[model samples]
Target: MNTVYIGLGANLNAPEAQLRNALDALSKSQELTLAQVSSFYASKPMGPQDQPDYVNAVAKLTTQLSAIDVLDLLQQIELQHGRVRKAERWGPRTLDLDILLYNDAQIATQRLTVPHYGLCEREFVVFPLLEIAPKLTLPGGQALADIAASLPHNGLTAISQYDEAASLA
Candidate 1:
């Protein structure tokens, strides 16, 4: 199994609950083993400010599925949650799952990119990612903490956490 990091974000339709549901769906998958989930960090919208703020978090897992397969699953989940793909970049959505890293590999396919294209610059991604894996490093060899520390981290606030007890019920 390959270790993978996934970034999750939502801004529509009960964003927090949507994130929790998505996380549950991932955990229940037979091909993937959910490992660590960081607390949700509420952050300002990355694109048009006309929309709502996003609740973001990071999830680490071990998966037998390949990178493309994982992307396919994530897309399916997004669609299930009423996400509609448009021409707009970083638009509001019910759920956004990004493949941040896939076992230290740099995968660039027609449909997906591991080490997600914006991992280093997005504070929403870095902060939650740090909470789950403090010592983690990107494919570029820079320490995760250093990258996170370098950013101003403005407009990001802790909202909630992944609750083991509630998830178990």
Candidate 2:
């Protein structure tokens, strides 16, 4: 099985509810087993400030699928929750599911990239990721704690926590 980490964010159509619905969809997938989920946080938008802030969280899972397959699954989940592909980079969306890491493997293709393109500097991702694995190190050997220390908190505030045991079942 491949251990994977997923980053979740939503800022439209009842953001928190969209996140929970996406989590439930992922937990029900047969190809993967949901492990732990981090507490939710709300942060300033990464793109144009004219948009609403995002609700973000991270999830750790064990999957039997390949990197591309996992990306495909994530896209499916996003679509199910009303995510549409817009040309605006980092624009607001109904849901965003990114494959942060896939068993520490570095994968780069036109469709996806692991160790997600902008993870190192994003407090929203790093902080939530730390909740599940404080000692995590990327495939490049960068310690997560070290990365966290390097970045500013960036106004991310916890909105809610997840109960792993309750959600796992």
Candidate 3:
């Protein structure tokens, strides 16, 4: 089995609920097992301040599927949650699911990038990821704690705990 970390974010259609529903779906998948979840966080939008702030979290999972297959599954879940293909980048959406790390593999293809391009700079991704895996080392050999220490909070705040009421199980 391969261990993967997924970054989840949403700023539309009840962002928290959307994340919960997405987590539920991931937990139900036979191909993957949802192992750990970070606390839900609210953060400023990355691109375009006009949009609502986003809710973000990171989840850990163990899966038998390959990275590409995992990407496909995440996209499917996004579509099921009403994600639309948009020409604009960082626009608000009902859900955004990204593969942050796939078993310490550095993947770069037309469709995906592992360790996610924004993982180091994005406080929303960094802090929550640190919450679940504090001592994690990135594929590039960078310590997750070191990355977390360098990023400012950027108004990111933990809004709620996962596996409590947020999982929607």
**TM-score for predicted model 3 compared with the true structure:** 0.97
Q: Lowest lDDT 10-mer window, candidate 1?
A: 159-168
Q: lDDT of all predictions, in order shown?
A: 0.90, 0.91, 0.94
**Residue lDDT tens for model 1, 1-169:** 8999999999999999999999988888888889999989999998799999999999998988899999989898888888899888988899999999999999887888778999999999999999999999888798999998899788899988888558759
Off by over 4 Å in 2: 163-169
TM-score of each candidate? Answer: 0.96, 0.95, 0.97
Order the candidates by lDDT, highest first: 3, 2, 1
Pick the winner on lDDT between candidates 1 and 2. 2
Q: Give the per-residue lDDT digits (tens) of candidate 3, residues 42-144.
A: 9999889999999999999999999999999999999999999799999999999999999989999999998799899999999999999999999999999
Q: Please provide, for model 2 over 1-169, each residue's C-alpha lDDT reduced to its tens digit, 9 standing for 90 to 100.
A: 9999999999999998888888888888999899998999999999799999999999999988998999899999999999999988989899999999999799888988888999898999999999889999999999999999888988999998766456556
After aligning candidate 1 to the native by TM-score, how far in Å is the CA of 68 from where it should be? Answer: 0.8
